[model samples]
Target: MRVERLVPLALPRGQKLQCELCRGPAGLRCGACCVTYYCEVEHQKADWDSIHEKICQLLIPLRTPLPFYNSDKERNHGLEQQLSREKHLVELTHRVAQKFLFEGKHKEAIPAALHSLRFSIHIYGLNSVELVPPYLILAEASIGLGHLTQAEEYLSQAQWTVLKTSHCSDAIQSKLHRNLGLLYAAKGNFEESLYHLANDIYFASCAFGTNNISSSGGYYHMANVFFRQNKMDIADSLYSEATDIWHSYFSGLIDVQLQTIMSPSEIDILCLPALRFHSMELNTIFIPSADESQQAEASQILNAILDIREHASRQQPMKTGKVVHALAMLHYLILDIPKAHELAMKALLIISYLQKQDSAEAIQQLINLIKSKPFYAK
Candidate 1:
């Protein structure tokens, strides 16, 4: 019933030991395992609580050097061990990178993504189609961190690999296009972004059904582009489609959870979907002039997202803060100054706790907006 451990250590030769959490130079090591290093006791305890406890013993096998082989039989055994280790290392590191990226922890994802890319090259060689997934992960993490040039480099590598392969799967094509779309969008090339996003939608629909949740991301990103362009009607329709896809998926999950007595850990699985739905629904609320009925519906959906987050075990502060900040924006738009200010302050506290200085700017701006009102001046 326990969650599986993932790859944690992938140190380079001649490099000094680094903290498992922050990647800073380290003098401390886990006493029990003595394999993983940390910059300080605090980071050590944090890593232990986050992942090391699950992976401590597992690190021993990965860290131990392979034996020298004398006979042919011994050589074959060593080769087999090497292959096994590389495969495990690539798969686990790739998954860990994906998990961090999904949680919006871009900085945290980079090390795991780099580790995955290294081991993937060891397993499948540099230009193999199998390397595409790790390249895509690195590209995504780079995009999230605003390193567009680095992301473009990784995406170009992926594109080259796909071109070299005789037959690439629709799934990989879909992901490649999605990242391309994201990169172009970040670069403010909306035309190119939309073209790539359209291809992303097509490939995703071809691989998974049109109604599949996997295809919803393309729709969501496309909506964001239209929304930014002030094309409210088109944005609203696209947002609706994305929201419906997520709503249907989460509705099923909520039903299952309601039927069974799920532990806190089990309930944690719903957090990501809830956050995704919250984002789409929040966008829908921004499509300008809404009737009272529409406003009521938006409130209901936002409250449901909060309820799901409330029950989750992890309580992801970064994501939760964004949700609260969005609600503050919604209240401000509706001219509910008091409610907006209260929620904005609450979101600021959460953002500050996570030490996200950039994220707090929007919340501070919202507070400034609330204070600038003529009614408040009196």
Candidate 2:
């Protein structure tokens, strides 16, 4: 229920806040972009030539008043090409907000999220449900920074907006419930967290099929709640359901894997795997214990699922690792967690790497398309 923070370390090792120019201990900020820090005026000025110039360009629009992007202004080409300067600025701000959120730069995310929310009101009325996504992002950043009260306020506004909407999408409803669940979880209100999480799962199930991977995420979070309560049996059941959904979702994607001859001894577990879970999640979280019976059960479960897993692995090692990893996590709930944690981590690396590869490929394709376009200048 608690939102986990596993932001990858971005700055150079051994130091996080160093002068971009001189690599010195730093506190001074660049006046234009207000993103980079420097140790001295000299270092800040030096960066002006190499980095600040480009950064300042991106931040320039923020200085001007952000106006409403009237959707009514679409041109002959399309809405994308017809965006007014104000509309473009809002889009840019929204992108920056999301990027900051993804990078764990919560402080920076706040202003961008605020800008997006403010501008969104012009497009959709102030009380419109369309404002919820930005509001949710603001709440997420606030929670990341431990601003619990501020986060609550944001969620409250969003909840009110959602109530006012006569027609809200399941996706939006799911997100709203998910954030409420996580917020209550962070506040140590387990019962409230459970309620919101249950609602989130219900809506997500409606939007995405019951066996879809996204719905499995809802199941995973609910499992975490059960695990936190020390309800090992229920937690294990939830974990099993989540993994089964994941396995089912990926089963049809790898025909080559299905066709390949799989050795029973080298069976792979097929599914999607997640990393960056909190130690308090309980499912894969470690605690010390040595039980021969627990170990025996773990072994038996793996053996029993081997044929099924091998069938999945012959097509995609990435997916198989995830399925096995998810199963290992269920063991962590009912058996010795430390061992299961190890297996989960190993599987996580494989799937997470593949995920990155898929993302990078997509970005590269976009870049190629952009470059391939014919450019015309005024």
Candidate 3:
């Protein structure tokens, strides 16, 4: 944890320096060089020249410290430590973008998504399923910004990366399939989308179990394809199925605190399919208000898990736009029109800068929405 404990760049040769902590042999060699482990000054003086001397100036700043993996437990711990930071940043970025998208402020989320993508590259590498998430976020933001072509381009890039990787983790593959299906759906290739989504569902079922939260996402996405095509009955059925999966998952994880299982963000992810399904049921296709009760229940569960306030607070600059957007929409839904307007405008500004690759419908919708709003009156 302390970079200072590391071998310093400037150390004289041959003086018998050894770390008091890990007991690792010190690289420095000087009679004055000494390493000690203590907090109080009294202890320092006693060990002065014995160990304290070498420890005094070995410290330096390290922006990206490689995980210290001297043992299996250490390696796992180190990875967990590194993963914690990265996950925090990624979650923050994703929340912002999600906020933007939910609020119909797609344009603003683009930049934040792009920045998140860089971190993702570091974590998942270029040709892994992990790339799918950041790419999909970017593509969606592009669509919001009226850069349909750019959205498509990023989606294609993600798909290519997924396919190219030989041994993708099941989680990654499921996510990739779900995203690809969504991409194809956006392009009006319903059948193609369905095919990919089916694959996503299959993989998800295997990865997370048939009744797992991960499986729900693919089912929910496939339902979107049917809904968009005006196959309301089929869409409704699929939505119901997805909801069942979520309900089962909720039952499974309900007693476990968010942090206890994986992390808060991971738990949030576990609930995402239900949240998304609720969104679809509420807005997209014309489902009777008779199901309003179900929507409310779903909303309550999703809200408790998603916790937009936390998501927004932790969001990174790379993903600030999207979090803002999602928050704006939630505000709008609650009748906080002013906040919604502000978020929508920010999303537009960001979207204007991205390439429109794969989302003609989304792009046009954003444009039309903005033009209709009083904020664009000037």
Candidate 4:
């Protein structure tokens, strides 16, 4: 599996380089893109195949320092070229970082995020409001990796930038507050987290209407905080609201897609496959808990997500496997080991068939979890 790919920063000479995939002491570098380092030949090959091939040449400009221009006209033209290139690089790295973060690959996200940060600094100066987005990305990635202190530093910087700006816009404020909320939650400061999350929701609702899909993420995060605090009623209400927003957004696409489809097999394939269950067996092994209602609500939301992803994945088998894997994780979260294992195996089958090494590794981890636990087997 490909590991974290840290872009080289200004460091002391003789410092050991980290591998692009493993973060081990790396001695080998990619011949095509010397900027990428690896601990071994196999890791180098894996990184190249997974992501580097597409970005190799694009990263070349970052490695090259801006040329010196003595003439005023030449300096102006050179700065213009630098700005255009930096903008493109920033967008590319930021998009890649967001994708990794979405897939829960936090370690892998850091390098791309750092690259985005570097380019953003070049394009907009060190303390510009435009740099807030990149800082937020780094903060979220750090939070995902459980680096709370580092996350705090990034969020603090973002907050300072927004505070200094005369008109930072509600959209940016919403995102900044959302990251602050997440950071506080990770630090176990529930009260502070909720306060920030409330601000996040308020600003998001102000920027985008209350019913907009963009505000759904704030609702979802706030719901999680409530769920952790055992405020089930509030959590359930928020979850329903968030899912309802998502369902409406996705259902619109689904309806439009359905109208153009004429094939019965295509429609049939979109229907989620039924999991085999022995009710009597499950009842004997699993006892109902007071939180069963919450679990049921969670299951309902996961099913709705699966349905939406199923239709969306008609042309993307890998996404189907990803959603199945997510469904397995949800079951595991709700303490349904047998069902989690079954769904995991199903996900593994789909991903393995598609020959996705990273996804297959994730499925294998879920299988390992099933084996390591003491849950009753069906």
Quantify how close model 3 is to the true structure by its C-alpha RMSD in Å. 19.4
Between candidates 3 and 4, which one is better according to TM-score?
Answer: 4
Candidate with top TM-score is 4
The residue-level lDDT of candidate 3 at 356 comes to 34
After TM-score superposition, the amount by which residue 81's alpha carbon in candidate 4 deviates from its true location, in angstroms, is 4.4
Better of 1 and 3 by lDDT: 1
lDDT of 4 by residue, 115-147 (tens): 677778877788799888878988998999899
Instruction: Report the error of model 1 at residue 131, Å.
Output: 1.7
Per-model C-alpha lDDT, please? 0.69, 0.57, 0.53, 0.69
Clash count, one per candidate: 0, 5, 34, 1
Global lDDT of model 1: 0.69
Candidate 3 lDDT, 168-276, residue by residue in tens: 6787677677666766777788999899999988888888777675576676667667867877677656755655554443333322312333344544433544333
Q: For residue 18, give model 1's deviation from the true position in Å.
A: 10
Q: Could you give the candidate ranking by TM-score, starting with the highest?
A: 4, 1, 2, 3
Candidate 1 local lDDT, 194-284, one digit each (tens)? 9999999899889987877667778878988887897867765676566566545433433342334334553443344433333322222
What is the C-alpha lDDT profile of model 2 across 189-243, one tens digit per residue?
8899889888888998899867665565466667667768877667656766766
CA lDDT for candidate 3: 0.53
Sorted on lDDT, best first, the list reads 1, 4, 2, 3
Clashes of 2: 5
**Candidate 1 Cα errors over 4 Å, as ranges:** 1-57, 68-82, 252-378
In candidate 3, position 235 carries an lDDT of 63
Residue 101 in model 2: lDDT? 61
* Candidate 2: segments with Cα more than 4 A from true spot: 1-112, 247-251, 256-378
